[model samples]
Target chain A: MSGAFYLATRYMRRHRGKTAVMVAAVTLTLLLPLAVTVLVRAYDRQLGERAAATPMVVGAAGNRYDLVLQALYFRAGRVGTVPASLADDAERDGMAVGIPLHVRYTAQDAPVVGTDLAEYAAFRGLTVAEGDWPRMLGQAVLGHDAAERLGLGPGDTLTTDQQNLYNLARNMPLRLRVVGVLAPTHSPDDRAVFVSLRTCWLIGGHGHGHAPEIHDDEALHRAARLAVEVTEDNVDSFHFHGDMDALPLSAVIVLPDSDKSRTILTARFNQATPGVQALDPPTVMDELMGLVFRVKRFFDANFALVLLATGLLLGLVVTLSLKLRTAERRTLHLLGCGRWLIVQTQAIELGLVLGLSAALACGLAGALTLLAPRWLGV
Target chain B: MIELTDVRFRYDASASGAFELRVDRLALGAGSRTAVVGPSGSGKTTLLHLIAGILTPVQGRVVVNQEELGGLPDAQRRRARLRSMGMVFQDIQLLDYLSVRDNILLPYRLGGGLVLDREAKDRAESLANRVGLGDKLGRAIDKLSQGERQRVAICRALIARPELLLADEPTSALDADTARATLNLVFELAEETGTTLVVLTHDPSVLERFDRVVHVDGGGVS
Candidate 1:
């Protein structure tokens, strides 16, 4: 056996170029299918874990996928808004706790999540890893990845991105002070910047603070481009002009007291409200993943065919190689080589090729799976 | 010593015509240097293979080293040939992927009942040095000249210190100077080891150097 192995190693080393090409071909053939399976499993677990945690989502009557995605992942779509008062109505009915969401803007390309920090943080199991929560108006708390990406910590300031620079009616960008950073949750929450709902409304031009000397209404009617910074000294002057209950919210995440309460609340919002719709997040996510898995099945079939073709090609290569080595085999035979030894030598060579290719495929697959979250921004 | 009595062998019939060889009786003494001179398609290589137990005859007994190979099983016959004989093929068939040293050590790796130890390796290197290939042991077969490759083949055949050495056209493709040197090396090694030597050749100049000459024509040896 050792003698057979020695000859096999020598042959492979001497013809290293052919060996390397064969190894690479087999590695890619194994890597493609292995990498796809690993990535799909990771996606399934990640999506399922997050979706199963949220109970229901209420938003404008439009694409329910958009509403659930906006409520859970803060991925804004074309879905319109619902009244912020819906959260209070759900709480008042003693059925469920509603966490209102206002996900209209971005800060440094990270979604800005405007909600009640005390309630939303508890609901999502978010805790401050550094400094305090967003306590004052215009104060911001960043998620772990958000803080790392923005390179901001406590006492630093962040500015919201302006939606339109040319429009005169658009609100001026707000400069927010970073107060805290949340620990990693490994969800979409890690990519968000959390702030108070009033601060978000202020950024939307619903409120402003001005110089104390401007006492006249005509002076108060300044252009929307006039920027505002809420400092501790002038924070008391900032107030909203419209009814607070009529404020726009992108979606509401409802956590019910029981199965009965959930069914009643879902019915109340889905049937009674004219333009508002409530949906189960897990059901919507399952349908979406079903489509994703259907596509994966097609890819799996294609990879199977590729593997078959690779196998056939490898078979042809081995056959041709044996044919080419007929003279060499005869030489070994005349040199007193046994028939069994010849077969053993060639078998060991094939085993070495396949073993190296399998190891490379596994290493590459594991690396790609580990990097999928960072690459896909999960 | 080797003996063949009434050996009759025929090639399998194909598109090419069938040919047969018949040797009524032939005897080669121990440590004798003999030459087999034959025309093309006259079965010189077939005669060498028969003496080495590589081919079986229809109605004859091939006795090599005092064992009748025709009565032995296939495996025992192979073992006897591997242990007691060495052969150099007509084409100098060295594996192209191996270096000169490995090509010389191939018999020990081929399950030939030879143990490959440090002493065996030393003997292989020593034979290569004797054949003027000591410095070129690490070079690939394709990198060597035709004469150098022929010398390597001779070294491989002699590495086992076999009692009998059979060579087919060992110097056929060499220039006169290299051919003489290669033949001289073979004679020196065989004489030093007291090995029986049989060489098949078509060159007339090679006949005078042997103790006895056998001629084959029309599938019969005289």
Candidate 2:
């Protein structure tokens, strides 16, 4: 056995180029399916965990997938919003604890999610890792990756990206001071910036504040061009117009106290409630992931075909290689090598190549698995 | 010592045509250097193969060192050839992938009958040194000159310290001077190891160096 090993190793080393080509071919053939399988599994695990944790979402009666995506992942794509009054009404009706979410804005390209941090952060298990939560208007807390991406810590300020860079009549961007950084949740939260709902409303041009010296008229006109920055001196002066009940919320996360409450709430909000629909996030996620996996099934069949073709080609290559080594085999035979020993030597050479290829394929698949969630922006 | 009596050998008649070798009697004493001279198609290589037990005679006895090779099974005959006999080929069939040192120690790796210990390695190195290839022991076979390759083959044959050494046109691929030099090295090594040497060649100029000469023609040896 040792003799066979030595001979096999020497032959492989001497013909390293051919050996490397073989190894690379087998590694790539194995890696394609392995990487996809690992990455999709990681994606399924992360999306399932997050969806399973949040029970329900309430939004404007429209595409349920968009509503759930905005509520769970803070994805921005003009998913119509429900009135903010729904959260208050749901709370007052004793149906569930409703936390309003406004996700129509961004700061430094990261989603700026507006909610009552006291309730929303606790509901989502978010804790400040660096400083404090956003306690005042114009103060914001950064998620872990958000702070790292923006290169900001406590006391640093960030300005929201203007909705339309060419439009001058719209509300100028709001500059919010970074009051804290949140611990990593490894979810969409890690990529979001959190602020109070009032701050979110202010950024949406619903309200503004002025210096006491400037009259309200001039300040109102100047608010369109000048960026808004809320400070201790001017925070008390800021207020809103219009019916507060009609303010828009992207979605609301509802936490029912009991299973009966959940049943009652789903029935009332989905059917009896006007202009609103309630949805179970896990069901919606399952539907969405079902489509994803259906597409993966096609890929799996395609991969099977590719693996078969590669295996055939590899067999052909091994056969040709053996044919080329006929003279060498004859030499060994004349040197008193038995038929079994010659076959053993060739088998060992092939085994070494496959072993190395398997190790490489595993390493590449592992790396892709670890990075898949972040790549999909889970 | 080697002996052959009434040996009749032939390949498959249908596949290989009418090639046959018939020898009534031939004997080679121990430590004697004998040369078999023949034409291109005169069965010189077959004679070497029969003596080395690589070919089984259809009829007759081939006994080497008092053991009859024709009576042994395939595996035992192969073991006996590996342990007691060494062979050098016309093409100096050294594996191109191996360095000179590995090529010399190939017998130990090809069959498990001999253990390739430090002693085997030292002897291989000493044999290579005797053939003027000590410094180039790590060189690839393709990198060596034709004369040097022949010297490596000689070292490989002597590495097992076999009782008998067979050469099939060993120096055929070399020039006259290198061939003479290579033949001299083979004779010197065989004498030093007390190995019975039988060389097959068609080059008559080198016949004088052997103790006796046998000629094969028209499928018969004299």
Candidate 3:
């Protein structure tokens, strides 16, 4: 048997082109399903991991899936927002660490995540790849991919994207200077721009700077126009009116200390609030994966069909190869090879083809797993 | 070392009387050279196969080196043939995928009885050198010419140090000069190894070199 295997390998090497074609064909057949499974499983696992990191998410309760996407992925939508006061209320009892998110704006097409830098960095496991974290209101930190995509680095500046292309009465876009770049985590955060909550309010027209109160409304308008770019000289001039807690937030990520507190929070806001919902992210993502599994089943059936067709084709090839090797088989028989040895020789060739295909399939699967995040951005 | 008695064998095609072999009695002493001469389809190749134990008689005894081969199982028969009887086909059936040395050592690998230990390896190497193929040991069979390939086959046949060597029209395809030379190599190698050589040939000029000559016509050897 071992000699047969050696002969098979030798023959395979001799007919390199035929063996390569067969190996390539079989590799593609195995790779399609293997890569699909590995990448989808990686995506599913990634989604589940990110969702699990945030145990509890609170947002306006219009659509559970939409809120989950908004809280966990920072997906832009017309979904309603909750007040910043809700985050305070959730954290006041010392039951959880409530972090507010204000995701209203973008800078150069990257989402501007207005968050408390320390808490958001801790929750997301973000470490600065370069420079330092933002220390003032007008500074920003770029996510790993965002920095690379925009070709921006520390000490560079980016203007906030215009909010009202159709409305001339809206607040003007502000200028934000880049202070740091975050390490690549292969998450949605890799595509975000992080800014302080105060900067978010500044862009929302909730705050403005004025040197002095002048008599003319035109002068105040001019003063407000002059405050578009926040700087160290104008830092003290920035202020917001009314209660700060009443400011708007896209969502509140609640990291509950215990399962009981998580359940209590979920029950407290589960359909009780008029326009807010507090739910577990993992549960919502499970529902999303349920829908994904249905799509995957279609691929699984198609993959099985392709596999069956490939197997039939390989069988036909083997049969034809056996017919062609009749004279060689006779020669082997005359060379003292038995019926079993003859069969083993043929089997070894096929096994080599299959073994090479399997190895190629595994390599394809591995590459898919590593690159799916960058390709699909999941 | 080689004997056959009351041998009766036929191919499935022989049901209609196309091909059959019946050798009443045959014997060859060790280290002797004998040639069985006949035309094509005259059972010359079939006689060689039966004597080599590659084909079994319908009901008779064939012995090589005093070991009865007709009643052995398929594996044992193959092993016995591989170990004691070496065969050279008319077309020089060397596996082109194997290098020259590997082709020569193929019998040892197949028989499973001959240990490919250092001694057998040394024999294969020396045999290649004897046949002027030592430098071409690792070369593929396709790289060799007709004469070189024929020499490879002879070296392969003798590598097992078998007691009986069978050659089936081994020189029919070569030129007359190369044919004579290849037969001379086979004769000299067999004499040196002290093995009985049974060569089946249609070339009468080469038969005079054999000490004994047997003629076959139809199904019986005379």
Candidate 4:
């Protein structure tokens, strides 16, 4: 090491409390902007990539943000649901494939997404890590994280979280068995549980596995009292009493083969089509991210202001440090130390602090970049 | 080894006050021990400072080892001080950040006609050992007791092996026994090194061992 560096290190080590304070100050100063830039950029990439992967989404004509979040993230909320027939209508066009999604409930604090098994799995590039996909009512296919988090696998049964305490008329919680777990895709799908649309209806109390002919009041009351868990003997007894087309679906993921077909289909479900809207997921997500980016920009401005203030504070700290070392400096001066050496010692100490803070800031930026999506759910 | 002729000094802009000092001609032979005795505010410290080249006199020549200190520039004067003289002040000015060994070797590290080498380290170790600081050489200044720190200060002052060793109120803070022991050690080290000793002390009982005594009061040195 250089002479100045050696002396500076010795001095800093001797005055550990003051050195630690300075290091902490510089680290915090560098961390703010570095973390903000990394997390914001990562957030933008996560949103943009998820939206771009899915070409378009069809949902009830209400909150666009809720629709995008539901179709892409499988997040359950109170958004309106359109009829499942819309998926058939979208499929009838023959230019696009419609995959139905019904997300209106959760199990074990994780969203339970109801979708067509083959289409959803193929669209998501899901490869089963264990067991088969859910094919029967009350059976579930878990994502990688969902399975790990719930600690349940094939043949293990779990009950859905209660939906409402005040309303008994709505869907009561249903017991579901885990049938499969998908491999990780590094997407929101990794945190959701999947089931077939028919199973979802059964869980919602719209369908049940009971004898079609209720011969007595006890049998009728038993059937009416609770939703049925699908079994081999009663699977044929499961049925929805209402019109099949009127069953609720949250959204339909449509992949159009051509741009013309996409434009046509999107225009078909205009404002004129009440309770339904079709648009590009990427475009909608872009608008949502735009709002978020504006807020980030504001934060970036505030961060710059903080940087200026911290810079001034550090300048003051340097000055105070020099002043505090005046006695040592004078002793060195009287002992034949060159005055320039004294100044260089302080500069070297400052350089070491800046170097360490820069290294720590880069490490924090890397951690935020790698872990923000997982931790913050971007 | 020391000479002063009509040395006059003023610490303030005004020339005539308690701070002004005028020393008439004074000379000390080589290897001589001199005690500078004075009351408080008698400019005894100022006289020592002048002779040591720490402060420049306004109007006379102060020579040490035949080099006129007032004739040299500030940098050369500092080199002369490092190469020729050692001083132990009343307040022990040991750098607490450094170990006792580093503090003793500081003169060589300052690099004015001195280089830190095996010879220098050996000399420091020997002086520390002679002054009963052998085990404390690697210890920090704060870890040492008052008597131990005083001995370290003496070791640091003598590590360069200068021709002239100056002590300013060395044992004023110690007990009577420690004070006598510290002085006897300083005297013994001076005799062994053959360095001319100039001790400034307020205690008159300590003056018995000196060959010459100079008293200062009322801005005049006699």
Candidate 5:
């Protein structure tokens, strides 16, 4: 046994260059799946965290994926709204209602959302990293990523488009003052632009030539009469004097009061209502993750197969290399080294290379995982 | 001391046409020097291998230092070889990776922290000096000439100061003068250490130097 160990060390030292190369190859092979596994686990963890944070989400019923994306991720294209009467009813039933006044207008391809102050506290779990929340209709607050991307901080201003870029008709832009910047949240809230619900109504009104003139208090009352009305009874009504139909709202977020209220509200809206549906957020997200996991499993299995093949190939190559050194083996045998000892020496050398590679690969994978979110800006 | 009685060995399985060995009886006492002389196909190397515990004769009762070699297990045979025997092969099988000094120290390392005696190291160094390898201790095996590597092998064989020393064609690769000097040094060292020496060689010159000579032919002692 001692002879075998000494021989193993001798063989390793004799072919240091080849052994190093084999170690590197094994390390890289082990590193690939380790890194991929870490990234997949982190991404899965992030998704799970996001899901658990939200108690529920309310959106349109048609295409639940699209609805959740618009409501949670704020990606736009949801064209549904619940009546203000429902929000009033939820609040009356002692529910903490969040009214999402969504407006899908973009400045330089980043979304600008118009929502109430309760939105900052309700679904987002937001905290003020700097400055204060929006105080008035035209005042705005920026999510952490939004602030970074738009190069806007507190005391700066942003001008939002009256419609999305593909709108055939153009209208005036609403000038908004940045009041607060949100901290990093690792959720969709980090990329949102928040403003007062009234600002959304004002932007909606501006497309109808109802924008108030900026001539101080004298012009304000005069333009107030000409502005489009956003009454609870006729929230969808738009004056046709300008591009009123191009008002930029893509969806509205609703919070139901209780289990009974949610059931009543969803039944009332979807069964009898004209052009809207209510969706459950958790169910939609589950369906989305199921699809993602299925695809990921397929790729993971393929990656595992490839790694197994590579390991087998490496083993075969080492075996062939040892066989090719038969003359050396014979010489050692004549020097009183038994055949079993020589074979064991070869095995030990291979084991050492593989063991070291596995350890190094695990470390590299862990480092990549810890740095991934920062690098990808997720 | 080494003893072999009516040894028969076969490299093949067949009853007939098998490589057979028949030695009626032979004994080499402690501190004695003996030579085995034979031509090609004479089983001289096989006899040495058997005595060194490298091979087990199919039919034989061999004993080394009162331990029955034929009845011992493989592991015991290896242990006996490691503790009591030293070998010099014809091709001078020095490990290519290690330096001359490390190769000479291989036996000590193999015995698991049994420190090589200071006296043994001194003796090895002195023997290497006598063989003109005093300056090549740190040189890699492949860097040394055939004769210098053979000299290193001789030093390694004597480093353990074993009770039994087996040399198979130790002077095959050396010039006449160098071979004579190496043989003289080996015999002198064995005498000083009281080691029983067994030399297997095809050359007749080696036969004249040993105290006893045995000629093998057709796998039988003649």
Candidate 6:
């Protein structure tokens, strides 16, 4: 066995060029499958972790995926805003409501979100990396990635666009100070800036020239304009910045009071609602993953075909090589070599080629895993 | 020592029974030099092959020392051939990829018994010098002329200093001078090592140098 290995090594060295080419081909074949397997598994694990961390998400009635993307990921899309009465309705039924007043704006490509401090604990589950969460109307808290990208920390001021940053059609910029930085979290929360929901209303009310400057106690009492009113007395008094009949909101996140209340509310809303839909997040995510898996299966099938063809080509090459060396083989036989020895030599040669190719494939797979994301813009 | 008894062999059953060769009995003792000469299709090469254990006779008892070649298993026969017998073929069969020295080391590698020991290497160098391939030991076999390659083969056959040496038409492709020198070197080396020597050829010049001559006709010893 050792002698066979030695001979195999010698033979490989003698034909190093051909062996290298074989190794490269094998490496590429092996690497594609290995990298895909690892990447897909890792991505699945990350997605599962994120989903499990949030028990349930309530969003506006529309495309479930669009609602989830806007509510959870802060991505640009159609949004629906439910009345503040929904929070009271949920709390009355015994559930905690973390209402987020989303304001779509960006500073240097990072989304800035305006929501109450409860949103930090509710939606993001964030912990302070430095300083404290924003308390003042003009102050902001940065997510890990947002801070890292903008090189901002607590006490550093950042500017926000007046309109959606992703859509440059409306260029509205707002200057705000960074009050805190959040710890790293591998979720959508890693890329957002958080502020009090009142700040969002302030920005929206500013468009209507409704900035109130209180000079004295008399003026302060009158300066208290109703921006968002949930109480019965002010419910009809809250002013809508846009057409009251066709108000636009990206999405509204809901939290039901109890399991019973969740079913009752869902039934009631589905029966009488207009321009609203309730969706189970996990179901929508599963449908999306099914589409992804279908695409993956297509790629896997194509790769399998290529792998099979390469195997056949390898077999053909080896057979032809042995046939071409028949005269040399016969000479060795006449020199007292047994038929088994010649066969064993050929087997060892093939094994070496395969082993080297597998090793190269592993190396190529690792390289691809490390480099592909950036190149493919992932 | 080598012995053959009732060695009846046929190339094919379709040929005439006159094509058969029967050597009732023949014994070549240690330190003996025997030459075989015959016309074409006379089975000289077959006899050499049978003696070298390269072929099995249909009915025969070929014994080298106490081990019977016809009775031994295939693996043992190969081992015995590699360790104890040396052969120089009619066509020089040196490995084209390896240098002359590496080719000489083939038997030791195949047997897995000995490294290139100092004495064996020295013998190889000396034999190469004797065959006028002193400076060509490092050269690949393909680069050498036919006569040069034959000299390399002769050196390889003597490298392990086997107990038996077989030469088949070693000088068939050489000039007269080179042939005479090659035969002289082979005989001198065999005598010096006190090894049994067997030569198979149609040329009569080699017969004059051997202790005994065996002639074959119609595949039978005559």
Query: What's the lDDT for residue A345 in model 1?
Result: 88
- Model 3 interface DockQ: 0.44
Candidate 6 residues lying further than 4 Å off, grouped into runs, are: A69-94, A99-118, A121-123, A128-169, A172-182, A188-249, A252-258, A268-272, A294-304, A355-378, B13-29, B32-42, B90-102, B112-156, B168-192, B199-218
Which prediction has the highest lDDT against the true structure? 2
Of the two candidates 4 and 6, the one with more favorable TM-score, higher being better, is 4
* Model 5 misplaced regions, further than 4 Å: A1-38, A55-62, A74-96, A101-114, A134-181, A190-246, A272-275, A325-347, A361-378, B13-17, B29-35, B97-100, B111-148, B171-194, B202-213
Tell me the tens digit of each residue's lDDT in model 3 across A220-294. Answer: 676566227778988789899998988889888998889888887777777566788887889999999999888
- Candidate 5 per-residue C-alpha lDDT over A255-280 given as tens digits, one digit per residue, 9 for 90 to 100: 66577776776666567655556666
* Interface RMSD, one decimal, each candidate: 1.3, 1.1, 1.4, 2.4, 3.3, 2.3
lDDT of 6 by residue, A1-378 (tens): 444555567667767898888877877887777877667655555455555444344445667777765666677665666544444443444544535446455666777676657754556568989989776565778888788889999878776654543753442454567878888876767778887665555444433233344478756554443222133333233344643323323444555556666676666556656655655556666676677778889889988998998899889889898897787687667666777777887898898788877877777767766664333221
lDDT of 2: 0.90
Between candidates 3 and 5, name the one with more favorable TM-score: 3
Which residue runs of candidate 1 sit more than 4 Å off their true CA positions?
A165-169, A209-230, A233-238
DockQ of each: 0.67, 0.72, 0.44, 0.44, 0.21, 0.26
Score candidate 6 by DockQ. Answer: 0.26
CA error at residue A204 for candidate 4, angstroms? 1.9
Give the per-residue lDDT of model 3 (tens digit) for B84-169.
77888899988887899888988876654777778888988999999888999999899999999999999888888888899998
Off by over 4 Å in 3: A55-63, A76-98, A104-110, A118-132, A144-175, A181-187, A201-230, A233-249, A254-280, A359-378, B15-18
lDDT of model 4 at position B129:
89
Stretches off by above 4 angstroms in model 4 are: A1-4, A166-170, A211-228, A308-325, B1-9, B13-30, B57-84, B108-123, B216-222
**How does candidate 4 fare on TM-score?**
0.88
Tens-digit lDDT track for model 5 on B1-222? 899988888778644467777888999888889999888777898898889777898887899999889898876777677678888988777778888887887767554233667876777677777778888877888898777888788778877768999999888888888788778878887888899999987778567778899889988886
Each model's chain A TM-score? 0.91, 0.92, 0.81, 0.92, 0.71, 0.72
Steric collisions counted per model? 0, 0, 0, 0, 1, 10
* Ordered list by lDDT, greatest first: 2, 1, 3, 4, 5, 6
Quote model 6's TM-score: 0.73
Between prediction 2 and prediction 6, which has the larger TM-score? 2
Question: Candidate 4's residue-wise lDDT over A95-159, tens digit each?
Answer: 79999999987888888888898999999899889999877778998988888898989999878
Candidate 6 lDDT over residue span B1-222, tens digit each? 899999987777535444567888989999899998988778898888888888778898999877889898887787777778889988777766567877776666565255667877787778887878889888877789888888888777777778999999888888888788878888888888887999987777567789889887777875
